[model samples]
Target chain A: DAGVTQSPTHLIKTRGQQVTLRCSPKSGHDTVSWYQQALGQGPQFIFQYYEEEERQRGNFPDRFSGHQFPNYSSELNVNALLLGDSALYLCASSFASQPGNEKLFFGSGTQLSVL
Target chain B: AQTVTQSQPEMSVQEAETVTLSCTYDTSESDYYLFWYKQPPSRQMILVIRQEAYKQQNATENRFSVNFQKAAKSFSLKISDSQLGDAAMYFCAYKGRYGNKLVFGAGTILRVKS
Candidate 1:
């Protein structure tokens, strides 16, 4: 079965520009979560989407938003990006039914370079 | 809020030897889950092992195992007979019983020298 897949493995943007990252959930999974991993740091939660709605979000600012399609694919949009936004954006997928027990399947992640 | 910490920034081990990575977490919830994820140079985060709070028995997967001390809020991963492929950044993660988000540690880089 196919695992989680993300688009544009790498991206480059300017401080005032916006970028969109796409993710396709693993087969048989519905819940999608986005994370940002800065250089040499662990990933920080961005937000989570289930049933086409954002169920929870992290401490990120409003500039970060996401959308989950009915098919379980998701997109992360960052507006007015800053240099600090230069990081690896990881997308993970898991089944919402077994939230606590299911293991999150992660994509290779898109490396965002903000100048 | 839940937080995970990995104090070791980097660790090295000879091939075929063993290495342990330490992790500690802070959480108010009684029931939660802990995980160890390995991110190689390819940047894909792969689950190494996991432990459920209520379970007394430690969790083990192949050559990887976890020492979970719920009372002390400590979780450590031990990799046996380390191989070159094991060289990567190992991250400690935590998840609450009610929430779906995972809190992660800064990560420890493991280097296996042949």
Candidate 2:
């Protein structure tokens, strides 16, 4: 079975510009979550999407937003990007029924560079 | 609020030897979950192991095992017979019973020397 897949392996954008990264959830998974990993640091949760709505969100600012399609694919959008926004954006997928018991399958991640 | 902490920023071990990564968390919830995720150079976050708060028995996966101390709020990962493939950044993560988001530690970099 296919695991999680993310598009735009790498991209560069300037400050104040917006970028959208895409993710295809793993086979048989319904929930999708996005995370931002700074250089040499662990990933910080951005938000989670279930049933086409955001179920939970982290401490990120409003500039960060996400969307989940009916097929369980997701897209993370960052507006007015800043230098700090340059990081690896990872996408993880899991089943909602299992909740905390289910292991998250992650994609290789899209590397975003903000100038 | 839930927080995870990894004390060791970096650790090294000889091949075939064992290495332990330390982690501690703070959470008021009686039921929660803990996880150890390994990110190699490829940048894919792989789940190494997981532990449920209510389970008294420790969680183990192949060569990876966790020492879970719920009272002390400590969770440590022990890798046995370490190999070069095990070299990566290991992150400790926590999630409360009612929430779906995961709080992660700063991570500990492990290097296996042959």
Each prediction's DockQ?
0.87, 0.78
Highest TM-score, which number?
Answer: 1
Candidate 2 lDDT tens digits, B1-114: 888999999999999999999999999999999999999989999999999999999999999999999999999999999999999999999988768888899999999999
| Candidate 1 residue pairs in backbone clash | none
lDDT of 2 at A9: 96
Scored on chain A only, each candidate's TM-score is 0.98, 0.98
lDDT of 1 by residue, A1-115 (tens): 9999999999999999999999999999999999999998999999999999999999999999999999999999999999999999999999988957878999999999998
What C-alpha lDDT, on a 0 to 100 scale, does residue A16 get in candidate 2? Answer: 95
Write down the lDDT of every candidate, Cα atoms only.
0.96, 0.95
Q: Count the backbone clashes (under 3 Å) in each candidate.
A: 0, 0
Query: Which ten contiguous residues of candidate 1 chain A have the minimum total lDDT?
Result: A94-103
lDDT of 2 by residue, A52-108 (tens): 999989999999999999999999999999999999999999999996576789999
Q: What's the TM for chain B in candidate 1? A: 0.99
